[model samples]
Target: MSKLWLNSDKNESVFIKLFQIINNKYPNYASQWLNSLKDFGKDWEDEISNNISKVFGPEYNDRWEEAATGYAEFCTEALRAQVFFEKHGYYKASSYSDIVKECYHDADYMKVRYLPGQYLSHYIWPHHQKMLRHFVRELIPKIICEVSIFYEVGVGCGMYSQRSLQMMPKAYGVGYDISDYALEFTFNVIKKHNLQERYEIKNQDIISSPIEKKADFIISQEVLEHLEDPQNFINGLYNATRPGGWGYITAAINAGHTDHIFLYRNPEEVRTQIEKAGWSIYDEQIESNYMEKPIELRPTIVGYLARR
Candidate 1:
């Protein structure tokens, strides 16, 4: 295998091992991806590596190869979706029911492939890493109020809620998701961290059954593009947040994935939608997957720290 992309002294064995597994399975693309990550600084790499180890325990050792395969397969599927989007100007999956039937209801696909791949992408994918950084550094720190209660909408891999509980030790998290697999994964994650007492997972859809009690902090990441009516979803988020509360919401723009339904053309479209929902954008970041692309074709992530 090629030399590790991250610093040798960092003791990032879990991360390096995952990379090796990917390289062994896919030599060419893995090598190119690792090479591209050489410029990713040590501090950022170290932080992500540590978070990965914390979130995934010894079970990851046995499943590293499976996770690596999942990552590769997921990327392949995403690329195919992106190509289709470029050709047709929309995501392949159009309806919430279709996504629920095809992606969310498939237990093997969610547990063994999509969820694991998405968990790794939080650390490996450059744009995802940027969004994670924004969540940890920019969004989390800006919440000056005491976060007694927080809500994590669409708790996919449960990383964001786990991070929130970690950062705000006194805060309790209520995670809502429509997918049973997602709730299960999130439960296991928080249980692994011994945060089960501080966090709770509910198999509920906030879009349909909005939280009756408002929270001081709410975070919904990469969920906007998954919904058919994101404006209403945004309004629900706003309603679920207490006055003077803080929210961190993220959406994908011109980015295609197997289950992504609604298409966001640009960051301003997302910003306007959030503003229309009565959120005052406090801080925001837009990170593109590519350094340069036609304005309409760029795959980007837009994250906002908003006040209710």
Candidate 2:
């Protein structure tokens, strides 16, 4: 059923037609899923269409509708999982080092999950990107007034680096990541934004390879949960930032996804780790899933701006 929508060769105009067919075929699932899109209003179609075109170009006709539906499906599935966990209170837990080791051993996991069109179509465009956009927007004043040299760790698609460089003309940035695919994706994103002059990226381990020069600001969004030694990672962010500089870091709280290994059950765990690294939280945002009955039943994506 997901394959039908994901591979369908239809564009935005055929959304209603596909919805009708889906409603007829899977009446129960379609009702809830279709209703979810209503939250975006009448212009949701256009908004998603433009996003699809912008992210994948006009040739990715199959992607436009899936980006919208897939997101709703993800929300529904996440909500279901959350409810199950809340009801049973049984959960799987693993050591951070073990999960980090598994991720390093299976490098392809990051590539297939991110690498531009993949995650952008499947997860980010639908689920995480808007929250990130809003987060960055709210911090725009800080970006413009305070930032100079920005360092981004695990810059998956370079969206944050691109936006930061765009918003701050005087700011130059360097991005570090362990994956070649991520580096390539960041390269393309920088190229797409015509920001070749403002950014430089390196394919290196951010934790092991010491940052030779300290930066005024740093961003490590959604990357902490992937590592085993988050304390060390936080310390690395601290080392990367000069004294009085700022850093924005984020991680998932009870958000169980395919590659999400480090499950911080509470956002305070993240704050404690950052504070241990000698940073103070300036602002925080915790976004909850929309379809959850109690809202708190769903996993929360947490972000924080910390100053050294």
Candidate 3:
């Protein structure tokens, strides 16, 4: 295999630490799994490291060594999910159905599977940060150049909301999610960033809860597939957005995560759902940054902006 980003001393250290931890917990899988990332070439290697730095901010250098422990758990969960896929095939359950709903809203499930720090550090920071960074640069300004009120659904750890609030000096934010852990995490983040006056976190289900007021801009990331009814969620988004307002929305396709129940075959399917929700798609992006384990096929993150 060609040289990978992991070949670098810094990146290698993180991976090695993660592997050692994983090996100690579950032997033999770490080395084999880490090797799968090697063939992705230098580009992916750079993307991963750069995005991680961007996500963790100035403190990343200080904490990354310790953060590997969380990443190990995250990787282990992904491995377990992959094993489920290999054994039972792609998990296909209707979004918002009883089974998937219980997985998302149940206290035990949320604690064990949806812990915000572990989820953000292990998955979003390492894997999806590039996509988010891309949004802040390319999508955010293009969609909502300036807004007084910003709303977000599935505010996982509040990174997106915090960043958006920071970037837009005049804007205040309101975010909604089902997880108590996520709400608490977001609350702490807003305080840590001295943005307490600028944001509030509500532990509300966006689909069923009243929006309170229409927003000048809205955002929801990595949330659609977990819903039992994504189209209804989209319509709710449309209802929450004010006329002439546009927002960023994201979903993953063929991503076999522990909680992802909806199976979107392609970006087109996502787009079709958005249009069906009575919104117009203005801009869109799709990228599969990592390949499936033991197979080269990548699961994609599809992003789009819908205008009200």
Which candidate ranks first by TM-score, i.e. highest? Answer: 1
Root-mean-square deviation (CA) per prediction: 2.3, 5.8, 5.2
- 1-308 per-residue lDDT for model 2 (tens digits): 34444554543543455455346544555644344354443465554444345554544355445544444454454456555556755333346455444543344544333343333422223346445656556876765677778989988767778778877889999989876667776777677667878889887776768888999999998887766678998999899899999989988776654445465777889989999999988988877554444544556678888899
What C-alpha lDDT values do all the predictions have? 0.83, 0.65, 0.66
TM-score of each: 0.92, 0.72, 0.74
Ranking by lDDT: 1, 3, 2
Q: Rank the models by TM-score, top first.
A: 1, 3, 2
lDDT of 1 by residue, 1-308 (tens): 54555445644456565666777786645764465356566665566556556655543576667777777888888889999998999999988998998888899889888888887777777888778877887677768355899999999999899889888888999999888998898888788778899999898877777799999999999999998999999999999999999889999999989999999998999999999999999898998876577868888999999999
Better of 1 and 2 by TM-score: 1
The runs of at least 3 residues in candidate 1 whose Cα sits more than 4 Å from the true structure, single-residue gaps closed, are 1-12, 28-37
- Lowest lDDT block of 10, candidate 2: 117-126
Better of 2 and 3 by lDDT: 3
Q: Write the per-residue lDDT of candidate 3 for residues 3-46, one digit (tens) a residue.
A: 43235454453344444444566464454435534544455445
Best by lDDT: 1
Candidate 1 displacement at residue 272 in angstroms: 1.1
